[model samples]
Target: MQTITLDALIPREDFNILSSTGSSSNTRNKQTLSIEDLKYDSFFFSALRKPIFQRETNEWDAEKVCSMIESFVNDELVPAIILWRNQGGYIFVIDGAHRLSSLGAWINDDYGDGPISISFYGNYISDEQRKAAEKTRQLVNQKIGSFKEIEAISRNRISTENDLKNDIAKNLGALAIQLQWVDGNAAKAEDSFLKINQSATKISEAELELIKNREHSYAIAARAIVRAGKGYKYWSAYSITEQEHIVELSKKIHQLMFGIGNINMDDINSLPIGGPLNSSLTLDVVTQTVRICNGLDRKTKTNVGDANEVITYLRNTLRILQYINSKEKFSLGVHPFVYFYSGIGKHKIGSYYGFLMFAKELIEKKKIDNFIQVRSRFESVIYQYNFLVQQIIRKDRQSKRAYVSIKDYYVLLMEIILENPTYSNEAIVEEIKKNDKFKYLQTEIVDNETVAVKSNFSRGKKQQIKMETFVESLPRCPICGGYICSNSVSVDHIQRKQDGGTNAVENGQITHLYCNTTYKN
Candidate 1:
């Protein structure tokens, strides 16, 4: 689904400060907000806030958001937005956040790249986000026209050349989004929200866990790292020093995992942990990284009473990430394409987590050097037989279980490589088949179903052909002889700089960061 991200449309605020048992004294809260009331500078818009625990407001795609706006402009039967006004005079959305956000986005002309989003994300938006915003803006403008243009036409300040625009403008005055307000305390409001959302859209288990533990260390760290420490500061309550520390750690981890530019089939050499930096995918990646690094489970809710604990968790996660890709002495500088991506350029989360587990085991056993010794041959085998990684992950299905088997597979592969550095692919496969643990690695041959052939290749086939050609032409690191990518490559001096190495072409060679910094030395 082509989902449009309107998460920045409705800002989040902690409603816990409001009295849990108190209700709004004023009974005159409006039951509707007109387009003018939702303008960027309007008091009604400023007072509107999403509850901190609310899931991101990016569920609706471009078509859905535009459809909602079209319905509203036509005075169609749109659902009422549910809200709860606190005693402190702030209105928290109880339900229908997506609906309000869609209208707010259209009025403010900010699908995501607008002023609100820039301010909300601290000017650190991703390319993916920017592209999605542009797409939504174009779709909305093409279909329903901009809100300002429609209003101008409605007021007769501009010529209404377009019939559809004129009709929508004529109905603009009668457009009022009906509002249903919760009349109880914050607790009651929250309960209503959970019930309504659970029944209506059904929040995913992962998202529900995040919402329930929004204040916990893992959740906070995940949110910070996913946005590269730029979006809403869930850790804002912490001391300035601690907040700075959290941001520093979160930024390092984010860069390590997702700093590489967006990955596509054309540029499959370098892949990030969760593919791109989308809100949903990155949340899963960060959440799993935090849990795995800290030895926490899915159900463990470790609350962050202070910023210190959040910083600690972030630092731990950062250490693991650094070890995975940094230039540190023990860092593996593991290439994502070699380990995580399949031969067909698809990212396998099962392979990613499995490699992480394997790395952690190496760290625990102080055997990183053992892996480093055979790193070249190991990476070669992995790159050449990438299909095996795909097959193993495909058979396992469950990511968690697949990761365990993958980790064991890595161990088994390393063992074989250590014993015989020049093992052939067939020899390795035969050996693996002998082991009952990896009996699933048995080769399966299925005859292709006969069908009418077409002149043009299917999309998947074209991608596979392209990937095969690209893989064949990939460059190798001179130091460890492993495949190097634009993101992971580092230039090193062939001759030691201290030994009269000059800035000449002959003095330089391409290598992985770890190899260039530590292995060569």
Candidate 2:
């Protein structure tokens, strides 16, 4: 197998290319330019006040970039580069930012990891994006060679040096292919972008919404936080101090979700921020969660309030999420089944967002402490009945129905925890079965075809053995006969030490403090 790294793909002519094309900020006054004209560094891509939406740069994978570069070099009939001139007279690319950036990356020898790309996106290009550029460069070199090599190859094709030079001049020099300049103000330019991109491939609905209302606070906060301030800073419109806070807050939120720690452990039962599934789901969830939490109807229909005000709410919201996963509080931190993962081996986007919706409810009601008090019991009930939750989630998966069903579980869980601070797993299960929506899950259990359901949560006895292997894994509380989590729990002698019980691991078990201290005492 072949491996590609960032350094392996660097062209020997990178410095020579940079040296040959000395700095010149000459604007492209002409509407048409050929592939050959792009070799120079003079054509500045400063068209719009912001050429590309901040969150969306280098989103194209290597194959797409490489294919685009090859298409341009082969002189294929490609789409026109849409241009719009700003008040500063800078020619900005309205629709072809990624296309132009791909070509520019080729000419400049800067595939995001390069110094030029570092400066381009303000040093926020992510590792995933940088690797993508590297892979693309490798593909481009394998297929079409570097820009200088392509120039040399074009020259080499002819036996006569003069003839080769003539070929380069005639074919490569003819930069005029196609260009469409949109004459308009910023709003008009944005509208053109939205209309043009509706037909373009690879633009998700979430991305389209963000592009359409890039100025909205939900959009701004989501973009800033999604990539951990490692992409274009959408919060650039805010004051410098506000921008700093946005970056800081975004970093914290990013860490909370994806940080390498206890929450993201190798153990399958670990608390989940996310898992390896849809790469784009993070941005979508964060952006939508912002709108959901802040009560924004839609990017177009709703006013997202002031940028600073949105940032303030987002920061607090993120902090609340962070608090739930904090190690110091109830060590349960986050329960994977409740928040991010279904009991089945699938990453549940519904579970993630549904839990956040629940968190938003908690924050709104100022019930963080109250929730914290019963978190152990809540986790216990859910853990013991993991198969039931998995059954509900697996039925819908990523559809709209999945979100509603999972949210129904969240609502019921919250209500039960609120009404009965110390509830039994059987009670919670009974409560869930009473709900009309969960009636189907109960029917599966009553039919005794739980083989499918059991396989999801435990894969049968193997999972039971795995669960038993973990030293910290405790059984249900003996006194209350409820599920137990590692929070406000007591280690008691199975047969009280006073009654001749030893403090051996086999002789000990975990129970809730109330059960051990009040009842067992």
The TM-score values for the models, in the order shown, are 0.90, 0.66
Please report how far candidate 2 places residue 274 from its true position, in Å: 5.3
Q: Ten-residue segment with the worst summed lDDT in candidate 1?
A: 15-24
Total clashes in model 1, counting residue pairs 3 or more apart in sequence or in different chains: 0
Write model 2 residue lDDT over 198-286, tens digit each, in one string.
77755677777776676667777877766666445556667888888888887777666655322322364444464431154556767
The C-alpha lDDT values of all candidates are: 0.78, 0.58
For every model in order, what is the number of clashing pairs? 0, 7
Question: What stretches of model 1 exceed 4 Å from their correct place?
Answer: 19-23, 157-159, 299-305, 326-331, 384-401, 445-454, 493-504
Error of 2 at 199 (Å): 2.6
lDDT of 1 by residue, 370-444 (tens): 787777788877776666776787778754467778889889888887887777766776687778887767455
**Largest TM-score belongs to which candidate?**
1
Query: Predicted candidate 2: what Cα RMSD to the true structure?
Result: 9.1
